[model samples]
Target: MQSPAHGRRLDAVTGPFTPRTPRVVAARRLHRRRDRDTAGRFLAEGPQAVREALDRTDTVVELFGTPTALDRHADLAARAARADLPVSEITDEALAALTETVAPQGLVAVCRHLDVPLRTALARGPRLVAVLAGIRDPGNAGTVLRTADAAGAGVVVFAGDTVDPYNGKCVRASAGSLFHVDVVRAADPGAAVAGLRAAGLTILATTGYGDSDLDDLVDHGRLAAPTAWLFGAEAHGLPEELTAVADARVRVPLHGRAESLNLAAAAAVCLYASARALR
Candidate 1:
């Protein structure tokens, strides 16, 4: 449908938009970190990610989808209507142009960045939390977020030089767990660790050189207390300075000849250990 005044194609039901429109251009720019940061928004693509974003209605700025995609996800459109958010239907060409993925799931949503501060997260008095210290890999970071959410942890902190939690890859890797947990970023890793300690959370640093073993902590019931697990990068592990301040440097015991667990695997083992102990 063409607008009477503007002469632009607009779908009444789906709010059809053109590829070169200002709204579309701005949303496409979210593909860049600088633009996303500037607009305080990021794109959540695919049915699951968009649905999850809509579940947190206040966080979703706008939703875009194709007519066919909206029909398939009728419930999402209905919910969006209930929340008073219109689902903008755009041309397939425009949707394809908006994302970097080879094939999109036909839906995209612009969501307000949902990260909080370390102080706010600490003030919640969270019981089980995962702290990523200087983790650069977005996949590893997102996997940890999902694992933390699954283990019933309270929050996931991307501390220090961690990847942007709102990055498209990280968000997709989280598989909607991004909306399930309280995510935060801390520019200063040491300060974040100190804050956690100050909040009465026993810091358990995962390191190869740790004095305490993870199994011992679980078997001995040491993980029952409110604790924060500090996970470093996949390649280098935790920094010595950060581990030095932790209440306990805990290591996952390996039975086989394997070198060590990857970042995500290590996080799953550690988080579930705490979850079981706390249960």
Candidate 2:
């Protein structure tokens, strides 16, 4: 008989599933980058991310959880019912074993990769987009994506050899914002920049040694235009060649003793600056 709660028939989850169960084992495989890439699927754990996944079309491949988790997140199950998505109740042990987090939060969602092409995102004529060039930190990259979404940027572009945006840690750090924004993975940084320029967006390269101060740009109304902010890896910042291609080298004016802002912080400051100016 189908369970009225989830509107799907599930096995009587007698106890925790063995770690060797086929479904559990398949989910465990996603812990590896290669497996995720090969499957074209990644895991989104916890209620928040899972909820966001359920809300998006064709994103959630499967939903798994323990009975307690499903009950705790009944709203999500209800939403899934409305969307005609199937939900399964796994054992707590199986849930924990399938995810990297110490606490599995009772639910996990397998979702399709959301990466789009750089040219496609650029073709949208975004008022603001973040171009992350070689940002290697998953936490920082995810935070930037969240910040860009909060700041109303039309999209985010991960250019060059940046960390995979679909990395588990990155997905967790995004805190549901991953579903709220269009994200592009650009294999070619140079070509990505060219596309942005062709779209008529002012490319502002952020660097510690930039020529124009961020405040000056805002005060001068320089940021009151369609723009894409170029941010680089924390260790090296933007390369000289990349900066040379930008319309301006912009820096955040820091008066404190703090040496530098972290990548995520810098991106937030830059993106919000543009958001404020353009308003």
Report the Cα lDDT for candidate 2.
0.85
State the displacement of the C-alpha of residue 115, model 2, in Å, after optimal TM-score superposition. 1.7
Q: What tens digits encode model 1's per-residue C-alpha lDDT throughout 1-279?
A: 533222223466545676876788889999888988899999999999988888784888777777778778877766665676656778888798676689897888889998888777777778998998988998888888999999988789888888889888999889999998889878888998888888889999998767898988888889889999999998999988899999999888988998888889889999998898888
Native RMSD of candidate 1 (Å): 3.6
lDDT: worst 10-residue window of model 1 = 1-10
Candidate 1 clashing pairs, residues 3+ apart or interchain = 11-16
> Each model's C-alpha lDDT?
0.84, 0.85
Q: Which lDDT value does model 1 have at 61? A: 77
lDDT digits (tens) for residues 1-279 of candidate 2 = 458855543766534455776777897788888999899888999999998988789998777888888888888877776666767777767887778788778888888998787767766778998988998898888889899999999888888888888888889888888898889988888888888888889999999989999999988999999999999988999988799999999988889999899888888999999999888
Instruction: List pairs with backbone clashes in candidate 2.
Output: none
Segments of candidate 2 deviating more than 4 angstroms: 12-17
